[model samples]
Target chain A: MPVIEVRDLVRKFGDRTVLNGVTFSVEKGETMIIMGGSGCGKSTLLRHIIGSMKPTSGSIKLFGEEITTMPAPQLEQLRLRFGMNFQFGALLQSLTVGENVALPLVENSRVDPAIIDLIVKMKLELVGLTGFENLKPAEISGGMRKRVGLARAVALDPELLFSDEPTSGLDPIMTAVIDRLTHDLTRKLDMTAVVVTHDMVSAFRIGSKMIVLGAGKRAGTIIAQGSPDEIRNHPDPEVRQFINGEPDGPVPLKLSPEDYIDRLLGHPRQKGVAY
Target chain B: MTLRAELRTFFFLNREILRWIFLGPFQGRPVRTAAVFRQMVRIGVQAFPMTALTSLSIGLTLAMQGAQELSRMGASAYVPNLVAVTILRELGPLLVGVVVIGRSGSAVTAELGTMKVGEEIEALEVMAINPVRFLVVPRFLAMLVMLPVLTVFGDYIGLAGGWTICHFAMDMGTATYIQRLMEAGHPLDLYSGMVKSFVFAWLIILISCQSGLGVSGGAEGVGQATTSSVVTSILAMLVANAVLTAVFFVF
Candidate 1:
């Protein structure tokens, strides 16, 4: 069975419909990359899949159990099976790096303190942050914080992982390192992953299956979905524009020049009129 | 948010805190006693010097004021009675409540609000750790246990301040002042003040934590929540003190 299945999910904030009838599923051991422009509901979709958000309508099933209406206690139980790495590190500022990573094991497991300490070191080493565990989050660089966040997320060796912009602020070399870790976790451990990222390189490097979300009028719906090669060579101009990082395309950047002038003047435009 | 909505959130959060404290242990999610102790040090032990200074000032001011007025009536010896009654029955808990609301209460709101905005609370949830259980309950337990202790300590310090004024200004012996103070105060006075402190502690922690957890936006939001938490907690404690005073008076 698919590890996660989102069907006809709709999320609305007042009159603004952020996500409109979006649907997708991820099978076990597959890495699904969700890519979109800013404010296109990439993270919103991820939040819903992870049960952090409740949809306005529709369903999300994790491990074949319906989770959209699950009670909080039950949802917490479901959370134990998966791990989510936030966009920023979101490491508790009050905790040391080792304490941050050890939080999950300490809270959820009955492991001995010595073993928990060992596991924390191992997780830190996985993220190349060994011997740096004694430092506070504020004492570290932004990139190091993000790596610590990853270590904390995977501390439990969860069966599934959800990462939001896992490589956004990192250098190209570190981005490759994180992408490799994602690859290793899924390939070696048979873990399922759903990542939301704007990093096309990282997306293409690790994504087994991919979905490109549309922006503007198309807002929360997928514009394209398939293998990396399929998305790379897709026929859709919008998809091509996003993947190639083109400045000019069908993607709307801002208000048109005429509209900008009209807005500033506080007047509706007349057809074919020069400002 | 509307007042009704704000109140609903407050009560809901209160219910969650109580549930986690009482029921979580049965579910094998017991409150972390270590975190509770850590929060006590932060909220209570660290707040000692400030509480001490404030209570001392209030006591000295009350004694001086009461002596001046009573001396005019040729009743200077009544100063001990006045100081003891006021400190033990009212100013003790009220002043300490204000101190805590200003110090630890605002801190709670700012800390929680930052956590909410940074998604640290969400991170805790995603790890199957309930934020209320892991975060709020510790603060709640700490405040509940420590506020009364602080209030009792403040009352004694305030009495000492009053004694300083009486012994030096009135030329009254310490034994005579102590005897008058004991004669003036009933056991109920201390109990009533303790009761008020407990209620104030509840309101302060609940308002502060709810404001923090409800924060959005960013740094500005944390600042706004902290301000609101302090203001609301003080107001709530004052109102509760009035009501409790009336209950004590009537009964």
Candidate 2:
């Protein structure tokens, strides 16, 4: 069975449909990368799959068990099998790095304190943050905080990992390092990963399967999906524009001048006029 | 958010907190006592000096004013009775509640608002850790226990302030002052104030935490939520105090 499956997931905020009939699945040990421009519902989709959000319609299954309507206790039990690394690191500011990494283990298990400490050290070392465990999250650089977040996400050796823009703010070298760590974690530990990122470099480096979500008219629907090479050679011009970092593309950067003027003047759109 | 929506969210959050505190232990998820102790220090012990100063000031002012007014009627000896009845029955708990709302309640709102904005709450959720259990219950438990304790201390300090004025300004003997205070206060007076403090604690924590957890946007949102939390808590406490006072004394 696939490790994770989402079918016909639709999430709407009032009349604005953020995600429209989205569907995807990830098999065990496969790394699926979801790439999209800002406000394209990448994070929202990830939240639904992880059970943090309830879809307006459709189904999601984790480990062959339906999770979309699962009870809170059951969903929490399912959550123990996976880990999510948020975009901003989201480390509890009051906690030391070691305590932050050790949180899940200590809360969920009856492990000895010494053993938990040892495990925390090992996790920190995995992210190249050894001996820095005593410092609070605010003491670390943004890149270092993200690394600590990654370490904490994997602290439980979870079977599935969901990362949201893991390398967005990092320098090139740090980005490469994070990408390498993610690659190593998946390859060596046989873990399944679903990563949401727009960093083309990191996406190409670690993504075995890739999906590009559309913006503007396309909105939340996937515009392209396949292996990394398939996405690289996609016939879709929008996909090409996104992957190549082109400034000009089918992607709408701003509203038309007429629409902007109408919005500024608090006037409804004229009848029979295209947005 | 609409008032109806906000009210719904507040009640739902309260139910979740109650469930986590009462039922979580049976499900092998107990409230961490260590965190509760830590919050107690932050919420109660650290607010000690401020609580002390405020209670003393209120007590001293009450005595001085009561003496000045009663002396006009040649009933200056009734100053002890006035101070004792008022402090034990109302001002002690009310003053401490306001102090805590200012000191610790706003702090909880700002802390949780920042966490919500930064997605730390979501992170906790994804880790299978209920944020209500991990965060709110500790503050709830700490405030529930400490508010009453602080009120008791404040009541005594207020009585002491009244005693100081009685002894020096009124030229009344300390024994006479204590006797009048004892005669004026009933056991029900202290109990009524304790009941008010308990209710105020619940109001402060629930309002502050709900505002914090409901925060959106960013830094400015945190600031707005904290301000709202403080204002709502004080209003709720005042309303609750009036209701409880009527229940105990009038009805």
Candidate 3:
């Protein structure tokens, strides 16, 4: 059985649907990457998998337990087995980097203070932030913050890990560093990772299986899903365009809030309008 | 959002905050007593000077004006009674509440609202930490413990301001003022103000927290939430004050 299975997942925010009938599964020890453009529901799908969001109508089974309708305590218990790294570091502003990494251990477990301190040091060391643990997140660079987030996420040694745009807003070198960390941690820990990113290079580098989410009319569905090499050579134009980073493709530029609303409400084309 | 939805969110958060306050320690590992105390020092100790200064000025103004009117009507002897009762029962709680709402309540909203917008709240959720229990409970408990104490302290300082005016400015003599205050000062009057301050503190924190958690967008949203926190809290405080006064004193 897959470690994470989501079937017929539908999430609606008012009149608009974000994740529509999305179906996917991540087997144990496999790095499944969910790659999509902005507003393509990649993060939404991640939220559902972590049980932070309830689907409008669907079934999500985490470790063979149907989590869609699970009680609050049970869902919280399931979340313990899962770790998530957000887009930004999202570390507590008031805390030092060491405190931020140790938060999960301090809050959820009964570990001794000395052991927790040891674990915090080890995790920060793994992320190349050993001596800088006392520094606030604001005191560090963005790349360091992302590394700290990764350290915090893995503090519990979770069975499954998730990341949302881990290398976003970083230069090429930092991006490579984060991608290497993700791959190394997954392999060393024998952990299943589901990552969401629009960075094609990072996705291909770390992903064992890649699912490319479509945009515009085909927004929520998986346009293509395969190995990184297979996705690199996928026949679909949307997949080709996204992977190749083309500006002009089947994806139309939504310029304004009014345009988005028009698309959402399905406005009819203007009569006799010039293209 | 509509009024119904906003109110629903407000009350729902209130229920959740109260649950975390009373029941969370029993259910979870243990309450973070240190965090609560830290919040008390921030919310309580930091506001002492501002509360003292503002309430003092208000008392002096009230006494000066009351003395003028009483002297005109040859009822100047009633000035001490007027300042004692009014400041103890009314302005003490209201002024302190408004000041705290302006100071601490807005800060709470902005702080938590920024956390919400930054995905810090989402990060907490992923870690199986209840944001309300971790964030709001400490501030809520602090406000509960401190607002009443400030109100009572404010009553004393305000009475001092009245005394300063009567003794120095009016030459009414400290003995006469003390005698009037002794005759007029009832524990029930102070109790009513304490009760009102407590209720006002709860309202301020509840509204501010709800605003914080409900924030979205970005910096603009944080500013809007902070403003709304102050406005909604003051309005609720006024309405609550009227209701409590009628319930405790009028009936």
Candidate with top DockQ is 1
Show where candidate 1 strays beyond 4 Å.
A254-260, A269-274
lDDT by residue for model 1 (A173-214), tens: 889989999999999999999999998989989999999999
Work out the TM-score per prediction. Answer: 0.97, 0.94, 0.92
Task: Quote the true-contact fraction of every model.
Answer: 0.94, 0.88, 0.76
Lowest summed lDDT across 10 adjacent residues in model 2 chain B is found at B242-251
Better of 2 and 3 by TM-score: 2
Give the C-alpha miss distance for residue B56 in model 1, angstroms.
Answer: 0.9
Docking class of 2: high
| Candidate 2 residue lDDT tens string, B1-251 | 99899899989998999998889899899999999999999999999999999999999999999999999999999998899889998999999999999999999999999999999999999999999999999999999999999999999999999998989988999999889988999988999999999999999999999999999999999999999999999999999998998898674
Candidates by TM-score, descending order: 1, 2, 3
Q: What would the per-residue lDDT of candidate 1 be over residues B1-251, giving only the tens digit for each residue? A: 99999999988988999898888889898999999999999999999899999999999999999999999999999999999899989999999999999999999999999999999999999999999999999999999999999999999999999999999988999999999999998988999999999999999999999999999999999999999889999999989999999999899
For every candidate, the chain B TM-score is 0.99, 0.98, 0.96
Better of 2 and 3 by lDDT: 2
Model 3 residue runs over 4 Å out of place are A171-173, A247-275
Best prediction by lDDT: 1
| Model 2, span A1-275: residue lDDT tens | 99998899899999999999888889988899999888999999999999989999999999999998899989988899998888888999999989999999999878999999999999888778999989999999988888899998998999999999999899898788889888988998889999999899899999999989998899989999899999999999999999999887798567878878798879877779776
